[model samples]
Target: MTEPTTHRTEVVVVGGGQAGLATSWHLVRDGVDHVVLEAHTLGHEWADTRWDNFTLVTPNWHCRLPGYEYDGPDPDGFMTRDEVVAWLAGYAPTFGPPVREHTRVTSLTERAEGGFRVEATGPDGPEVWEAGSVVVATGGYHVPIVPSWAPALDPSITQLHSADYRNAAQLPEGGVLVVGSGQSGAQIAEDLHLEGRTVHLALGDAPRVARFHRGRDCMTWLAEMGLYDTGVAQYPGGLAAREKTNHYVTGRDGGRDIDLRAFAAEGMRLYGMLEGGAGTELTFLPTLTAALDGADDVYRSICRDIDRYIDAQGIEAPPAAPYTAVWEPDTDPTSLDLAAAGISTVVWAIGYRPDYRWVGAGVFDGTGRPTHSRGVTALPGLYFLGLPWLHTWGSGRFLGIAADAEHVTGVITGRKGGARTEPAADLARRRSPGEIASDVALAG
Candidate 1:
């Protein structure tokens, strides 16, 4: 085996997706010397893993990269999977930092004196990196999570996660029972249903929002209403929005509602949460009505906000419509038989959990979540970014990552007040002529 290569830097950023690249941008702006390590190519998940018909749940306006906003012709529209991939890839060259692609970090061991020692395997071979600071930007969606009893599924039924699902042609000829009623589950169910497949969607307590209201998108109104400004630490009405399920909406069909109730109205069978399965029998909880009620509550709350925004701004906009989609009680078996229902596949669209096994002990909580405050961990020089509620309601989103990154860079560089104060000479040294041109060419 070849000897491990070693490099040193002021900061080492793990993962080269939106979060990592965003962090790198601020670091470059501050003239901090750092390198980005990506397990695959930049935006690997978006470029290679997403389904063929996959589009963003958020619109193009929310697809902002650090220091760059979307200025394309369709600012009000949504970006397809390919557009998202290209957007992220195009972001990196603007800063022109050295991104070590195809490099997978195996371990992050904190040095006794200070800083961290990052070990990885790259194209050539094993490599070692020592850095003053380490930013774990691998993102929250690291691993796929299925129920504990997923292995007990029928031998013949094919199992896959939403991350692995591509299209209807990839599965066997039969109905599909999709578990989890989050955005992914609802969208996948819709995709399968649109392809003429009988789909049974297991419902959870997910909220629904109208695709658009009045003359603007729901998200735009939310931003105007200051809903996106609500941080997890102090949400309005003491609501723990972090624990709440993502609102059920879709970017498909130029932004549309894709709630479970709507799916039920379209002939797709709706079931409760997937409790467990033995052999070919799957058990569901009696939570169908409760889930619908929860969605209705969220929908009403959003309409209330829209009404308040209209009155507050004194804008002459049309009245918002009420949510009318209602769930029909199904007579289907609570405990379903796969053979009887002709379900030859199960798609688990449940959310992901973080795994810090590679990270040295003492940085994570009992629940495997990293212990941090606005990306700053207890250990000095160790930080985290891209978590669902790391700082705010939009923490994991593309639009919110830059603020978190700026905060973390502030923590790293000790610039805690007043103006940025970054010297003009530092910027001139870091950004080349082409990079300067590219940065200026982006949306201001």
Candidate 2:
């Protein structure tokens, strides 16, 4: 019998998403021999998981993936889900990322003698890889979560996690109940509302941010304000802030504020956080008003920050009025009768969590979170990247990938601490027409 093949490399970067690719970008510059292993094709999540009408909440400019910043026709504009996949797909070929597509890393264990062993199953079947260093860039969003009572709902009512949801037409012809008001929940709810379908939202305590504030995008303003540069150590809530639900906002239809109150005024129903459910009935808390008000508080706070910045900088900006609630719930409904309301679908956008047991128990804390400073774990040469606050606010996002990747690569390359931007001079390098044409044939 043929033995499972074993290959050796300097580094093994698991996950071929933007995070891994970003790491690969730096490794290539430093001339490191590393391979990125991905369970599926690169950017498959954006192509498969996101709703059909999905677009970026952050504008195109924030897609600064190490070498490839968004230089497409739309810099300020939000790219559609397909465009995002294309942009990511285009990235690997330009720099020729040594990525093994369709390769699933089953386990990563440390060798007793100063290296790591990676076991994976590829198209050629099972194989093992040995590397001096291992970077887990798979990120923290692995398992999609729904409430415990989801399975008990009536079989007639279609239930889909935000990860599995594609479009409104895919569901049964009836009203939709979107549980959770985070980015995905809010955007998906808006998508359904635009389709003229009845959307009953179960709002969570996640804050909302202004899409376009004053003369620029809120992200743009925040970036200038050094919000993205704030590291985990300096973050207000410290490490505790990492688990916070992201502020919900949208960039759909050229970008605008997501006001659940406005949505409510337009006939969409709003409920509080989901508590439990049985059959066709779902129970919620009496925090609908609190959630909306909390969201607005964040929105106004962000706008005020932008306003202060504009005033401080003595920059002229457009005038805007204070946001007032467009509508309010006459009664905070603690229960939603799906069958009675004609709701045939429940889109749960609660959130996701990663299971890191496969990486072994030594590196994780009691809470199952990686115990690392920046991306470096207690175990030598075993590191994590692309997780929220891995280094800074930008660490989990495109805006910070380069710096984080550079920092991690610098350590692997024996340069020690600090990220360098000098390598980015090679970022704008273009691919030949033939090279670009032959790379990554994707489907709509």
Candidate 3:
């Protein structure tokens, strides 16, 4: 027997994180009917994050949702992973939006009548929902990228990605090995070391930001100088540059800073990029900036903006010290055999990319990222929000998503949830040369 299909609301929001909740908040404010579908319990993914010491790098002041402020002890203080999860869970109830928990959206496609068909699986079995609009807020950081060589390591040595890591208790008694030098990697390395685990961090070409300067968060400096405020039109090359710089810094609340070079001074080993083969030695460069010159132009522009802002404000804030800290990869190329170093565990924290297999054609570029002006996708009534580096440098970050969500909501409601015609020149300019070439080749 065929189960009857169900229909409700004007829009459907996938994922229940900060982004999804924020979208729902906007929809309610606009008096638009919408339902949020979460695969697990509210904030379950964040609650299940492996890092015990994980906290928002951005302070509380900037972490507001659409209608609710992040009202906690320290407005400028960093929030732990638990605190973040709890806050997101509280948002929907406070705003009176219906968020359906444990509902996993299996697939989404356009309906025959020009709406959306969302197929989902829940405790009640397979269900089909029809809506006029869809918001793909599934988030960008859900999946972990484990290198293929990772499985070659001996099974006896416990290996887990940063996402699966919780506390030092989950690791073996001997010690631990942390791979990737991104923000998560660096923070976890410091946490394990503080927990009394003899830590060895595998360094990559990731950049670093100072924890604080002149008694203010580095992010505040970036915002005050209008660095994060620039849009793609004003700075076409800015997004690519920000991706390379790795400007995130770990906070003191998470753990004491374990400088990659200073790790060796504290009797911890630092290894650079790992070559393939059974026992390849790790190599290092003096500093990562040589590989990061492409990003320096953007940083210089930001610094210039800061200088101009200071002069215009006539504020007597003391200038920050000259940036002398050299964040370099490990130079001593010794093969610290995992078995020999008593390292029984490994954690990979490289980064994340979107997987849009379920999304049909015409909505995404070759990269699988949705094609959108701000949050509106290419297809009519299909929109996306809360993607990493979606528009600005901080667009997908905690502090930046709310503005994007509000803007998207305004577009949806103002036009009665219909697609807007793109100006020909604007459309042509948005496509990259490579994309145009691909289209031409396909036509030929």
Candidate 4:
């Protein structure tokens, strides 16, 4: 959809990803006049930002984008990168959202007169749009975080953030040193390893989980257990859990546990947290064993939770088997010469930094995190949606966005002068049958 030079909308949502589109769907259904402004094409994050071999860690069934729930042939299977892109692209037209792609929001400020003033450069140069309320649905995982010490590495060795890493072929032919073992880092390491490349993994304390246990997807068990529905305020981590690194797992091929120990057993080099070094020398902490142990604890903790849930529900599932550590490190190497190790590339899978700087100053605290109660900000008429832990563990994921979108929309509808819906806290509080009342997104 095209926007005029000067335009007005009842609501303006900034972003065109699943989160933004989900909010747009709710607004459309409620008969709210709104426009969605996107910096890139819809689904560009899945298409461009992700690696070539990427598949969602979550199963296809969770790809519930408001009206567009996954009805694909294999709901339990993971969608390939192309499949995901197509699915997301197909979602917009189903509800006919007023989305202006490639229009980056440069600034958003609350107008003293009332409402909001949004400035952006679209296809037709600078454009100004006014709206009564604004929703920032640009989900977390924004800017790729590379350390300031990164420049100290040798010049010949290629450096790529996990965002820029498409495939092993993109890097020079040699061993690859992958730093950070979060979801992206672990998956990328596996991708490179599967391609028959020499992979050196720099481990962080990111937890790992099995894809399937007791003949069901872990997600399946968790969903039924209602772990995904955990609210931010109710979470043990409170809001800080939003900053926690996701567990390392995979839906690659069919889906399986990413056993870094297994990788080590297969002769892949493993190191501790990278501590940085100049020239070709790279130093590491002796955290590999501890990181590995910590990850195992989380894995076993999930198994225990599922076992307890099954027993409590009186469900006739198979007996749970304990996870035995496949391998253990004798001594973690503290340093390696990149040239000596034949590592020609370094993939920084550290993670992304949230960037809400374009939004007004009052929306954030000193730390720059947007402070709100389930997307409703302190300042009237402004909201946040699709942020990690905004409402629940599923809040930002495909598993939870539809309900969150609806809840945020409900809040907007009921704000002061307008009356279209009631307060939406209950929408988030809705529970599934037999779901553990105390179960959190976190297993422990």
Candidate 5:
């Protein structure tokens, strides 16, 4: 075969999502030459993967991508998947980087000459790039993780992962059992229930938080209290925190609050964590009360922070109403037979695990998790970004990616020993008149 098309760059940033784009912004600002290799068009996940009416769990104000922040009228509101995708698509051209869309990196090998050799396939066919450094900015949630017990279920019952689920009409005619009570699972269960389909949600230990507490957005209080600043080491759960699911909250109902108990109140069934399946029968752990208790604890924890913030800021605001509804699980029907309940569909929203198979070995741990200090991998010149809890709890989120990217860039450039510096001028140019006002709020 003919030799692969060869090219070279100072740095090769892989994946074109928010993480990669944020990294590119820092690199470009520092005057580094690089190429962004994307498997598909920019923000394809937000465009194609999410359902039609899917709204973000986080509000629009949290949509801070390095130089850009949400400046729409509803800054406190949540953005739909399409709106986010459109914004990202438009944001890509702002910096004018050399981005090669539709280029999928199939393999990444270290070169003896002290760099990386990236092999990818693009529209022009096989291509190769030699770079001094590589940044894998692929955000989390690449693969849908179905439990080991999934295959044991009877094949007659249809199954789909949350990634594949689009709308209620797509599923078969029957009750829907949605596994995992995280944000996605809870929202989907609510959607199905609203569509007149019977929905059953597998209870998880995800915490609950109100959309607005005490006349202030919950996120604002959390951010001010440095909640997102919590790192993996400092996390109360330690390693377990890395795998913990997000709180059960939704942006639907005009940005109103939603939680697992709210779903139960809306006439959906709630069950404990799925244990296993025997033919058409499914067994669940009897931890429903524990899950509800855990959520209550989280809510209380947040409320405590809100109370503290109010005291510190000296701003008079209405006290939040005490949240009292709790789901009382029925002790009788723990195990349910799918056929008997008329449940023909199962949606697995358990979570996701990253696949670094294409990258060289030894950079990841025995469990295939990357061992990195903030985004710096063990291997020199190989880095990681956008991983959950990589540097902090918000590292994987849009609002936090910029700081992480800036830190990684400092390490790469040896500037101020990996410390972050505010790029006010760069950010100001990217903001609209409306966005400038929001940016001011972000600074405060």
Candidate 6:
């Protein structure tokens, strides 16, 4: 027999990661009744990620929630995957938000009246809960998408995606081929090489970052200068500037001391890598120019702000580092073919895209991402936080999530408008049993 549907508070938060947890924390602080539904144990998904030496590109200070600081030794240092997961697990209980672990939300349907009915399955069985709103904090990085060409690769050679890669232990003894030149790919190549694996890094036109300190930690400076807030909504130009600068870091003050050139110098081989679908061959010249052009305004602003701060403090600003490499792609045919030489395992670190099939219909754009004003969806009370480039360039990044969450919270509590709601009963009737069952099965 089908179990009776359960009714809960006004808001239901799906996913218990940093995004979801932060949303719940804010909801509770505002006295907004909410329940957080986690499909797996808190931080369990990270436990299964393959990269062993994974560290957030963004620093720790930015890794904060509404009321809590991410207290750790190295505020400027990036946290390891374990540290991040542990931090999230610890942060979840402090707010005491009701978190239903292992509860998988299969389908979310909007009630015509105004609310939502969330169909889920847990250890018990099929369960349904009604909420005035739903917040999909299930981040864009959960699923690892390897191209179809991966399986077609010669099975004899060892190949693994960055998601399934843990450490050098998993790589073949001969050499490693890290596909995709994003941060993850570079880091993995470095890690494997350090572990004594001959590493070949497939080079695409990747973004570059300057490794220097501007003033305080880069994140602290960003917060102080209001970069995160500036990129939100009203400031579309600032948002665009932020997005472009994020493509590659400008060499200036104290920042990370790692970059692609540094990685190459450390003995990581570079080869040509491109999106299998994009016919355009990877080149450094135009890509670098694009990156530099995009980041120029943001970097200048950061420098100007630093100067102002230094002047205010009556402290002499240090000399800037000599800018060395311009943004450029390697178009050398020889460099592109290095993979065929001896590279074995290829780690795809090309970044993540949102997968929103569970969100049902009428809410997403052609790209499968939720369509919202700030965080409020067309389906009333349904909200989203921590989506990549949601409104601005920084929306998906660590510092940006907080801003997005705050805006989302504001929208949900009636402090803001542009939201629609669905009645619980009407939402339930909209979903087919098959769709609900499929979602539940995946969550399980």
lDDT of 2 by residue, 1-444 (tens): 547799999999999988899899888887899999999998787798888899998867678877677888656678989888888889888899998999999999989887999999999989899999999999988889877778899999988899998888898899999989999999999999999999999988999997766656677668767777778889777998787888887878778788889988999999998999989988889999899888898899989988998799786556655787889889888998999999999999999877887886398877678988889887889989989888777778887888888887887888765455532213212234332222211100
| Predictions in order: lDDT | 0.80, 0.83, 0.67, 0.83, 0.80, 0.62
Tens-place lDDT digits, model 3, residues 178-237: 878777887888778778789887667765554444334455556655556567546766
Q: Is candidate 3 or candidate 4 better by lDDT?
A: 4
Per TM-score, the best of the predicted structures is: 2
List model 1 lDDT by residue over 112-133, tens digit each: 8788999999999999999999
Model 5, span 1-444: residue lDDT tens: 757899999999998889999999888888999999999987788877898779987767677876677778876667888888877777777887678999999999999989999999999999999999999988766778998778888999898899999999998899999998788887888888889899988877788787767755577557656677667888787767777777777777556566667678778888888888867999888888788878888887888878877788785566557778766656624688899989999999887777889987488888678888898988999999988888777788876788889888888888774435333223323335454344334323
Candidate 6 regions exceeding 4 Å error are 1-5, 214-216, 232-255, 275-315, 325-331, 334-340, 391-394, 415-444
**Each model's TM-score, in the order given?**
0.91, 0.93, 0.84, 0.92, 0.91, 0.77
Where does candidate 1 clash, by residue pair?
A: none
lDDT of 1 at 275: 83
Each prediction's RMSD over C-alphas, in Å, is 6.8, 6.3, 10.7, 5.1, 4.2, 12.1
TM-score: model 6 vs. ground truth: 0.77
RMSD of 1: 6.8
Candidate 5 — which residues are off by over 4 angstroms?
237-240, 417-444
Write the residue-wise lDDT of candidate 6 on 125-199 in tens digits: 887888888899887675666766566555556656677788887666666767665556666766777687777
Looking at model 6, residue 111 earns an lDDT score of 72
How displaced is residue 263 in candidate 1, in Å?
2.5
Model 3 misplaced stretches (Cα beyond 4 Å): 1-4, 236-245, 254-258, 277-308, 323-334, 415-444
Native RMSD of candidate 2 (Å) = 6.3
